[model samples]
Target: MNEADALVDGEPQFWGGCEIALNTEPLEVIKEILKACGGRLFEIGGVYKLYVGAPGLPVLTMDDGVLRADEAETAKPIRPLDERVNYISGSYTRPEDGWITRVGPPRFDASRISADGRVGADLDVPVVQSGKHFQRLQQQLLNNAAKERRHNLPLPPSAWGVEPGDVLQWTSEHNGYEDKLFEVEHVTDDHSLDSVAAVLEIDHDDYDFDPETDLIEEPDGVLDVDRPAPKEVGSFAVAGVANVGTNNTVRPAVSVSWDDPDDADVTAIRVAYRIAGQVDEPGYAFSYEPAAGQLLIVNLQPATNYEVKAQFESFNGWATETTPWLPVVTPDIRFSQNDFNAAVNARMAQLDTASQAAIATVRDALVNDLTNLAHYLLGQIAKLDDQDQAYQATQGAAVNVVSEEVVTEKQARAAAIQSVEAALDDAAASLIGQIAEVDDKHNALATLFGQVFAENGEGAASALFRLIAHAAPTGVAARIALEAKTAAGAYGEDSAALFLDVIAGVGSVATIKATAFRVQTATGFAPILEVQDDTVKIAGNIGVQGDALVDGSVTASKIAANAVTAEKIAAGAVQAGNIAAGAITANKIQAGTITADRIVTNGITQSDADSGSASGAANGTWRTLCTINIEKDSGTRGVMFLGIISGSLGGSTSQSAADIEGRILRGTSSALFQTSVVATIATGGAFTIPMSVGFRPGSVPNGNHTIRLQVRASIPGGVTIAASGYLYSMLPRA
Candidate 1:
């Protein structure tokens, strides 16, 4: 047989191995021969050959309608039958398992098999090392098995040759047969005289194949088969509007809810919002996952309407259509500007009323005092007139008598008249001085009250007027009245001037009141007079008619010596400046309530404690360390001294110590009280001794007395005193 036929016949000569007669089929026998040669069998040019490491063979491609075979001869074309296989499936034997066991898990193209049946179930006899490699091999085998037609083409006699592992390409003029490429499975050449041509069996290479490298390139533009398709976005809507804060410029947040597309390709939703009429403001935008379909849009204008929109994105660079713009409005903010103005106006009006009432009270008090003074002066003048009339009558009778004795009597009467006139003149002078004093007081009060309510250029009246204008936009009458009142300094200066004129005897009280208000009657206008009676009554009722008057209108000069009793003064009205030095005796002060705070200086104050320190004494001796001088007035009934004495006493020997004593003494001589003796033996070794003493020295005489803390140790090596010792005295309440 020829060499190609001999190889196909499983000849032992082709492979250097011991071969016995094969009882298997022809294909099986050929496979056995190839296995023995450590190669695979391939059929080419109607002959079978052994192809060792076929995957590692150089690939060939068509060049100018010719096969550019690598390390092989040129390629030739053959007519292929239009045989189509509907289904392609593959199976492989696991290399780890024995050759008898096949891979149980089968892999196949379901769509292809459904249409083509099991005709394409092909066994891929590749020794796959792993399931993954097996799968790849199966895929390739399945693709190859699904080819429509495969042919064994005879090579032209003019060509050098072709090998089983070479690749070839050519075009066929046959109907439906166009340009095609193939891989030469096997090549064969017969050397006998009758055999002239070499034949090649080829499989379709529908995919790009690089023969020189034996690698397949996937078809151009093929997508990543593992990726999923893009999904369309679903509808979204605004949930509700959240309450915005009260600030005008504060941003608001709107809540939104939507359904997730549930698509693998959908990564997130793009959300954006803008105010309804302010689209140009370039509002906010954000992105969120489809799973979290809800979003909060923030930094929006308060009390403003807004529109929101959403869209979905996909893996394939596709964006779904945006959802419709949803309408939403932030909550309305409260506290408008007008409301604030109204509140301010009401407050100012209340304050203005109070200030007016205070001024009226002072004015009326001064007027009442002036009226009382007027009545007194008038009655005194009337008394002087009666005395003058009586003297005139007496003088006339003396003149008519005309004798020596009568003359003498007349001279005596004249002398008496002179004395009486002198007394009257003195009385008049005193009344004039009082009138001047009252006038000064009235001027001083007027200046003070003027400063209190109307001096700062923004007086109570001016402020009230402005507030009234803002509060009552349409109340012209009210606004005009406030304006007029403010212009007149809230009637403060006018009232003060009028009262001053009346008290200075420039005008009568009735005339002054009428002239100030331009009233025809003695009584003032209702608004001015309504408060007059109440305030005048307050002044008039200050003291009983028989009692000496003590009121705000009464100056210090007018008060009699020692007239201001405790019952006559209000609590807290007696300030420090009002009382003379040493005036507040113990009787004047509530006992025990005279705290250290009441004494300004030279008392046991906080600073005294800070500046003082504890002192120690030697054995059998007393040390007068801290001395406090307490001021007691005449009526003081009880005095108490309290403090703590802290120190440590050491004895030279254990049994050499007696006791340490702390005593509180009053004045220079009296030992008011003492703490119980603390045994010095107990404090022998680096220990502290604390003694607390509270002493009441009965009723201390009314004078400045010295109080002392005396410490004595019976026996001591050395005594160390802590610096926390302090003492103070207080008056016990009666």
Candidate 2:
């Protein structure tokens, strides 16, 4: 086939231009060119080819009959079903600044983001210079990455010609897939089964992205928060008292007018004022308005001076520095309508007299100036007419002389060109001879280099062949030898610069015999790994096999939190000493695992306590002061009740004794488990009783028992009794 003719027929009709470095790899240049044009590079029939845009319409159908049923599952997803690739971010060359910049924000699919937020991808398209083009590429990549659903369809012998990158449509009611377009990503031919299987991916074109219509422009300018101050102030003054409120009340105010800042982002004008020479003491009065140009700083003191300034406020949270202070003083007194009228009339009378005098002076000057101009014009016109007549007589002779000079100049130009051509020919001959001589010298140098660099010869071994080695056998005088003959130097290397890429042959270990060995990074070289005695130490992370650790070798300090599982530790291996104090919280213990046996001796398994007042008890009748219910364990032995009761036996006559008693009762039964009679009141005076009672209900059922502290007075009239206390249920050691 004619190569040129084939290219014209097969290649794209449109032409495009690109720039690349001369020293760039051919494959890299090809890859960049393809990426810039939204194309893919592929190999077919042993020849590389380029295809642009999405694959063509489906040419094959993957219906139920074309799929294999033997496999347990046919439809699969390349990525997790919940993981979405909605956002695509990368860097591209910005044409405006000739620098690599982000392609605006990431191109995103809002629908996918709403469904699943794990959507992110980065695709570097360095060759794409236009921001719009870079945005389009990002959208395309996002769409491609979103096709996570894949299907492996096994086909019969009839479907043999399908290849990767071929577009196909699939319809499977079982998997709920309709007539969906899919791109073939991989194919495997089963020779034993006489069948072919293809891995198909959902095509990106179905997502729908148009480069021309759906483009996003790169944003520009400083952020709205960074807006600058307004450029100019129009006016700042103390206007006369005026009605400046909704009630039409008169008030002294300062008027400030400023030009709006040029920035479109400027959202408001901030005006501030302070008493003159007292800005730092009281600070400034700051107020902002949505509009610019003018503002009224009202409610100021009459006859007072103020220093006012204004600045700009952006829509976001940022304000410019205040402008220079503008000084203004309020009027001493409010000017009434009569005062304004009288002042205006006086100024008008003075201006009217001055205007009439100026008009008379202007009328006299015009008449004098017009007469002088007519005389000067008549004298100058006669002189110009005589000069024009003399010039007309000499015009013909001057034209003839100019024509002769043109012919003579043309003849001299032809002679100069002939001489220049002869000199150029001689120079060309000399240049060719010099070029030949240079070529001869270059060839001689090339031969010398070839001989010096030859692999096997009396010529020295080049640095290219053996990176660090002696060149020829001129001994130590000419070339440096790197081999360590006796390990004698301080660094242990035979040569000063023999430490890079040194190789010990198979069945031997290459040792870095220096105090430290460093690896190179972009910034410089630093030791990342070190050998200390029998152990290896790494500055960064190091991976080791699971079996590499010895039994019980990893201490608590070396272990990460939650790194050790139950399977990792042998049963009964963890002792009490191995656990840290408070390391095991209530949530860490499994429910129902802390039985009564696990509790310590005299643990006080359950307790309930309350403190309150009690009163309104009839003589010889009990009033419950506080009640506590304990759902104790079977091993609970007894409960302890302790508190103080203090109150006056009121309604008792002088010298009349009143007996008071405190008792602890179980449930609502009248039988008292414990009782004390320690209060004796001689009169209606105040009395204090210290009550400490303990109860042991020998045969009481274990679950949920109510205990109460009741107090009563043995006086004739109803006596008041008040108490406060606590209840504790203790368990004995097993």
> How much does each candidate deviate from the true structure in C-alpha RMSD?
35.1, 62.6
Model 2, C-alpha of 678: deviation from truth (Å) = 99
Predicted candidate 1 versus true structure: per-residue lDDT over 502-560, tens digit per residue: 22223323223322332121222333122343243222114342224445555679778
Badly placed stretches (over 4 Å) of model 2 are 1-19, 44-49, 68-73, 81-83, 99-103, 190-195, 203-207, 210-213, 220-734
Candidate 1, residue 228: Cα displacement in angstroms equals: 50
- Give the number of the best model, judged by TM-score: 2
RMSD of candidate 2 to true structure, Å:
62.6
Instruction: Point out where model 1 deviates above 4 Å.
Output: 1-49, 52-102, 120-129, 150-155, 172-179, 185-734
lDDT agreement with native, every candidate: 0.44, 0.53
Q: Give the CA lDDT, 0 to 100, for residue 394 in model 2.
A: 67
Candidate 1 CA-lDDT value = 0.44
Model 2 residue 657 CA deviation (Å) reads 99
lDDT of 2: 0.53
In terms of lDDT, the poorest run of 10 residues in model 2 is 444-453
Query: Which lDDT tens digits does candidate 2 get at residues 184-287?
Result: 66567766454444555656554354545686666753323334444443443334344354333356777777654556556666676788888364433343
